[model samples]
Target: MYRLVVLAAAVALATAEVILTLHDCGSHDSIINSVRVEQCDSEPCIVHKGQDYTVHVNFTATRTVQEAHNVLHGGLGFISAPFPLQPENACQGSVTCPIVAGQTYEYVQTMTCPTFAPSITVTAKWEVKDENKQDIFCFNTRLQIKS
Candidate 1:
């Protein structure tokens, strides 16, 4: 009986570790998009004030959950505005495809900026949370917005 209990306890611990492994989703990948900044476009993209521009944040993630989701939340500090460039809208509007667990998903986030002029500084903080609102992982990226 003692041997059986020990064996069962070991199996349970192993199973728990597998279930709680670090699973991440988004632009930063050590083997893939590990560069300081995932650059999009030729840089110095031009746009007018009060207009929206799409900045693509490239990333990669190891899929651990059956369905993985990515979101982009950050601040855009321009010569004028120091807060977020857009309103507080969940980045769910940017991604659509489903990410498989244990797999690597290379993706790009197309974020909308409410208004930017001349040149602005863009900084993004991202978090991947499970369906239960548990944070699976986090990542940060920064870029210089030019127009």
Candidate 2:
């Protein structure tokens, strides 16, 4: 019974991805279709300390690109704090380099929560940039950190 319960929990966690109410930021180009966060079933996703969370973003590209970069931040409002992203190169992570114009793409990345983070409500924004360092698209969502 214990093994069954543990296996059930693992299966649920593996398939749980909440459709987030994503907010748009001023963007250069690209249309965001949807955003999903792991282990969240509603708005203001709960992120546990020292845990890994994945975000999947679906968008349509409006222009051709040779390279793409990932930028992430955690903050309250205007007080933005940059979060260090592993494999900052989006092309290496999810996107393929030399992206075609008018093509749709999905960006998937894993985020590791800082163990030192306070249990507080904060907003996280992620941006995929082009070769010229322009925003392909920018989006934000609310999160609650727990210890």
Candidate 3:
């Protein structure tokens, strides 16, 4: 009976650990190997209003991109203005440009939660484009916030 109880506890802990980790929201292109919200290590990653968080992305570029940018949209019409990816520096933007084909890259960015933000769920979309305004890679994730 003691062993049974220990096993049950272990199982519960494991399940809880999994629940605390961020979950991928949708399928992405092969180029985008993985997208992780560092701040949201657990499911429904929670963010405090007026705090800062980070997102980590792993991907491979299939073709060279001269100009790149990213756009993030959240619930209740919250939209992050388009920004450059700085592909030459390893695609370090919501949009990364000038990425060389056949190379793997890891990108990380820290963002601030606005003070005016309300409690809600948010979906962040990231993309990389070329100078011609064509998509190279795209990925997204979901998160929660509290005031």
Name the top lDDT candidate.
2
Candidate 2, after superposition: displacement of residue 5 in Å? 14
How many clashes (backbone N, Cα, C below 3 Å) per candidate?
Answer: 2, 0, 11
TM-score of predicted structure 2: 0.87
The digit string of per-residue lDDT tens for model 1 on 91-147 reads 344433353434444333334544533365555455545454544345544545544
Q: Per-residue CA lDDT of candidate 2, range 34-124, in tens? A: 9998667768898999999888888888878888898998898688888878889988988898878799888899989889878999998
Per-residue error for 12 in candidate 2, Å, reads: 5.5
Candidate 3 accuracy as TM-score: 0.63
> What is the lDDT of every predicted structure here?
0.41, 0.86, 0.58
Show model 2 residue runs off by greater than 4 Å.
Answer: 1-14
TM for candidate 1 is 0.40
The worst-scoring run of ten residues by lDDT in candidate 1 lies at 15-24
Q: Which candidate is the best by TM-score?
A: 2
lDDT of 1 at 51: 46
Clashing pairs in 2: none
Candidate 1 vs candidate 3: the TM-score winner is 3
lDDT-best of 1 and 3: 3
Model 1 RMSD, rounded to 1 decimal? 18.3
